[model samples]
Target chain A: MLERLSDKWVTLVLTGLASGPRRYSDLSRRIAGVSQKMLTQTLRGLERDGLVRRTVTPSVPVRVDYELTPLGESLMPLVAAIKGWAEANIQTVEAARKTYDAA
Target chain B: MLERLSDKWVTLVLTGLASGPRRYSDLSRRIAGVSQKMLTQTLRGLERDGLVRRTVTPSVPVRVDYELTPLGESLMPLVAAIKGWAEANIQTVEAARKTYDAA
Candidate 1:
């Protein structure tokens, strides 16, 4: 499970779901640039790990919604902290990159 | 940089560095289960990205030390928060796991 969440797409998917339950297509739309295959694979992995719940309802064309489980919801604060940390230190990291490249 | 930090070993290495500067061998030891190849690779990646500093002292047996750069140290609080969040909600996750398994 720990190993599973370490992927870039997984983190992005989780961040997208942090907003609310999203259908498969909506998730693919919300996270720009992820391939359909990758999005589906990541979502299944999250579901298998018990981090996400997938609900399928009979509709005109089968409506499906994916939402954070308790386990997944519990991870939100940590994700937010990490995102906040990244935003806070991006300046220093960029400056360091410039310095490193100059060196 | 964000893409790079999303790896499991990167997170583990950053957590290990959160303690203090450590030699390559010490980091391998401190992390308590990372493969030598993975550790070296992850450290090299961090160094390349300027998130970590590598210091070498010339001697009969040359000593090399690695530590968090300012940007790396900046991630400590976030790492701590994530780890702390995981620790705090472990029970909830576990319970969720049981419920999930039973279902």
Candidate 2:
């Protein structure tokens, strides 16, 4: 389970879904650099883990949307926290890397 | 940075060092499934990221210890929360997977 949660794609997909439900294309576009195959797999993994819900609507194009389950919603804060930490500390980490590389 | 933080080995290593400083062997023993190469790589990555500190004591056979740096310590609560969520929700996730697979 930790392995699943620790996946980079999982983190990105969850973040994409955090605001609300999104169609497959929306996610693919929002999470730039994610391949279609990787995105699909990540969504499937999250769905299987009960952290995401896939909803299909009967429409002309047959719309498909992905959103967080309550279980998934519960995990958002932690995910957000992790993201926040990354954004806040990225410079520090980069500096450390440069120093380590030089040493 | 998010990619690094989302690594399974990173999660395990951080958890292993949550208590205090530990020798390389201690981390190896504690994180049961990690290989020597992976542990060494993970520790090196953590050190490079400025999340861990490695100290060597030149005594009988020389002693080395790895501990969380202040930056790493700052990230611990979030990591702990993630681990806690995994522990608390494993059953539900397992059930979800079972249901998903059956369908």
Candidate 3:
């Protein structure tokens, strides 16, 4: 849904997983500000939406990894473009905000 | 910021203003599900973020119009892409959700 995709965590999670499969701990570490609960919820939401795939190994300790599905991968270009635009225009936005606030 | 752009109301508001300037009432009407309060908040946020421009006219009822700034207009392509992806993939996402929930 447009609403869900608009969520910041969802964008970050999707972009983060774009690189490759990552364990829970790795994801938490890589995405600096996300809490464990938030990460878990986001992954579940993405999985339910079919944008993320979760894999669990049958090893002694049992390891879990998360990666993007083909559908999710397809979303990357748009996401990346948005991210690039945001970074490039942040200063302009900030200046506008200050001017608006002053007036 | 990327986080702000990901807000659904922000996206709708930006896209709504994409066509041309719109009055507060017109925007509320055009964007079907948005409440007056939410619309005001979203627009203020967008204005603060430098994406939407708010103009006040000293006419009979003192009309206020909203339009996208150059920076905001620049984001239109990315937003359009995301909306297109969502519309195209909704069924896929829904089917995936049902499958995930059932299992």
Model 2 over residues A1-103: C-alpha lDDT tens digits?
6665557788889989999999999999999899999999999999998999999999998999999999999988887787788889989999999999999
The DockQ for candidate 3, computed on C-alphas, is 0.66
Model 2: which residue pairs collide? Answer: none
Off by over 4 Å in 3: A3-8, A33-35, B1-6
Mind giving the per-residue lDDT tens digits that candidate 3 earns over B4-67?
Answer: 6567888889888999999999999999999999999999988888888889999998999999
Which structure among the candidates has the greatest DockQ?
3
lDDT of 1 by residue, A1-103 (tens): 5555447788899999988899999998988899999999898778766789999999989999999987888887776766676777778777776776777
Worst 10 residues of 2 chain B by lDDT: B1-10
State the DockQ of every prediction.
0.37, 0.64, 0.66
lDDT of 1 at B23: 91
Error of 3 at B18 (Å): 1.4
RMSD of each: 3.8, 2.7, 2.6
lDDT of 1 by residue, B1-103 (tens): 7655546688889988888899988888878779999899888778877789999999769999999988788777766665676677667666766776677
Categorize the docking of model 2: medium
State chain A's TM-score for model 1: 0.81
TM-score of chain B of 2: 0.81
TM-score (C-alpha) between model 2 and the true structure:
0.82
